[model samples]
Target: MTNKQLQVLKQQHALLAQFIIRLSLFYQGYSKAIDEELQTLRGHLGSNANFTLAHVSINKLNALLQEDGGVLRRFKTDTLQSVEGAAKALLATSGKANANTSIIDTISQARRPAESLYDVTQLCVQTITLYSQVTDTLPKPVGVAVKSHSNEPLQAPATLLMALQEELVQLLDTYQKRLPDNTELTILKQKVVEGLNNDELLNVCLTLLRLIVKDSMQEAIISGKVIQSLHHSLSSLHQGLNKSIDQAHCTFAVQQDDNLAMRKELIKLENDVARSDSFSALKTQTQQQLKQVGSALEKREENDRLAQQALSGQLEALKAQVAELESKTRYYRNRLAKQVATSQTDPLTKLPNRQAYNEHLRKLLDNRNINEQSLCLAVVDIDHFKSINDRFGHSAGDKTLQVIGKQLSKALDDNDFIARWGGEEFVLILPGLNAKSLKQKLERLRTRLTELPFKFKQDRLTITASFGGTCFSHGEDPDAVFERADSLLYQAKRAGRNCVVTDKDDV
Candidate 1:
């Protein structure tokens, strides 16, 4: 070999070895086996490296790369399967949809061992968008906007999912209030509001569904009873009508018989008079016939009077039956009304519940002249409430809630509204209050809560709460206003509880 060619070959070998070491370092921590192989390859290429050693390490790295490629292929397959499964679940829950039928068909017809993940990914994205559009059309809760004061960015899917959850929670609250109070229902609703994850949320929703079914069944039973009562009343009315009809027919036949007998007596009298030769005989026959006619007429009058009395008795009975049925109907109707009111009422605090709050907020937002009116919303969370519950019994906690609810209600104006949002939280809607007024009002309430004399198990304690409030700006989103207010409330929470945070000046 020529000296210059040999020197060029050595330089090329040195460059190749350096490249191999760099490549091995790049593959570090991919897998334990891969890492170990790279480590050994690095050692072989270190300080005292030669052409044969470089060849061996390069071959080993190439084999490891191939193995990693297979793993990547498997990962891709698993991810596609997961996506397909998610798509199926969406279809199952959403029911049949004609708009996405082709997409669905493509997914269903795809081979078990997917040929292309890219195609699957595209289809999945389209399906998800379809579902998103449908969900977006659902009625969103009033005062739920998606602006957060956090560093973490909120993705569209996550935000939509949260909106759906809020809607669901609101729906459950509505149902819970309109029905009767239940322990299980209350617990599930609280968990849902407190932000249970999606998997746990599904389980909670199922439980809530069962409760709703139970309530529906109860309502059905009540309706069935009402129907049965109506049916029985109608049957009685029918029987009364039939009996009156038969009585009328019997009276009619008796009257006809009496008339016929009276006619025959008169005719016999006339024939006897014609046959009589002496005037005295005629007079006697006439007298006897006239007496018989009088007796028949009297009997007919008595029969008619008795028949009238019998009819009067039947009518009275029917009237009593109708009155009783009316009274029962009225009673049940009133009971149902009471139940509806009860459903909207929080049993613990005897205040309007979250369902009531939702309705109230909706009305305010929907008002035609809402822009002119000053509307303010606030959230009050009792500081260290869980601690109270943990230390004292639930009864104490219940009492504490009741006292605070009443005090807060009393502290507000009559036109203002207050409700038990859930647990140890309360919501207030103060109309005709501007930002400055809102801040002052909230501060006053915060102080008032601390002043409340609370005693639990012979231990005197002072209770306090944190407040977050925001006023609705003209043409601003009601939900955005609410979100801003809620964010402030948490800020208050973070700033040592028992304080008021508001977007009064900012708004």
Candidate 2:
């Protein structure tokens, strides 16, 4: 053989070796990608129970990759076995068309390794696109369920997968762009594109298979069986891919529904809590109002008790006064019957004359029963009465006496009756009153009278009175009570006017 021819053959062999190496690298890279994807899915499955759809998709992908690998291995073995036949056919071909036909036949019949690799790559691409669309259209169910169950969102996995898919598509695009556009490689590329086409390529593949068996003169053989098997494998891959897509879609839908339901429930719960809060506030307010009402009721009860005590004391005092007045009426009637009739009562002041006061006291002592109630008498005389009469005339003095008389009446109850005993001096009788309350009532009356404003002509005048009181609890004679009260009056006149003094004690 010539050196140039030998060198040409050596160059051809070198090119073939380079093509095989590149194909092997391609296969290795594809396998690694499949392995990595499978590992990622396995990790997800193990770590997350919610990744059921992903687990199933990964299992299907692994199975598809395994089948593809088997197909590729078979193609490699068949191609090696058919290499000598291909070379012999190439040498014996009479025209360029025949040589091309021979090469095409060899490729068609020898189980092309690139075909399975192409299928695997397409599967990977389709799977990634399906997952991406699923994730984009709805949230990842695995991650959503994880977050739902664990109360933690898992955003990293979906983000990483998106980035990886992008990288894979770029890598595939780069590899496709880098491939040499030689005639044989161009034909291979066309075949790949054709294989991706659903109907036309399938018909061409069937025709090629039929022609091969017909040329071999194999009679009564099912030529369609081989096509059917390829169809079955393609169908399996398609179905698996479609199933994975459906699963991803379903998972996404479920997660969306769950999220919506959770949100609705949460909103409802919040509303309920708000309602509860309103109710609680209302209840609290009601309780406060009830407490205020209860407090008001307590205060009312206390006031009622005080009023009841005052009324009871007043009622007892009235009963004693009625009894003493009955006895005094009898004594006065008897004295009037015995004495000469005299209109000695002062009409303006309603006070008894000095003669009448002396006669009444003597009768009271003479008619006194052993069981008769004791008398505590006070003589209240208005101070500076004569000066009042001089300064404001007789009308002013008469008004002053009337005011003092009214004040004295107001100070005494029925139990302690007051009769203007003589002139400005009023006399009082207590049937059963203790001196302390009686004295306090008298002092209050004195204070009220001092505070009163008496109008005389166009002028306002005020007056003060001095009071002398004595209790005759054991004295059988009214004279003794009178004398004691009179002595106290003199002592009050000596000490100071407009003051109350008792003969019994410092009342």
Model 1: lowest-lDDT 10 consecutive positions: 153-162
Candidate 1 residue runs with Cα over 4 Å from true position: 1-212, 249-278, 358-378, 384-397, 413-416, 429-441, 455-462, 466-504
Per-residue CA lDDT of model 2 for 154-251, tens digit only, reads 34232333222222222222223333343433443345332233243334334433443332222112223433544655565556556556655665
Clashing pairs in 1: 177-343
Provide the overall lDDT of each model, using Cα atoms, as 2-decimal numbers: 0.73, 0.53
Clashes of each: 1, 0
Once fitted onto the true fold, the runs of candidate 2 whose alpha carbons sit more than 4 angstroms away are 1-344, 352-368
CA RMSD of all predictions: 29.1, 63.6
Cα displacement (Å) at residue 206, model 2: 99
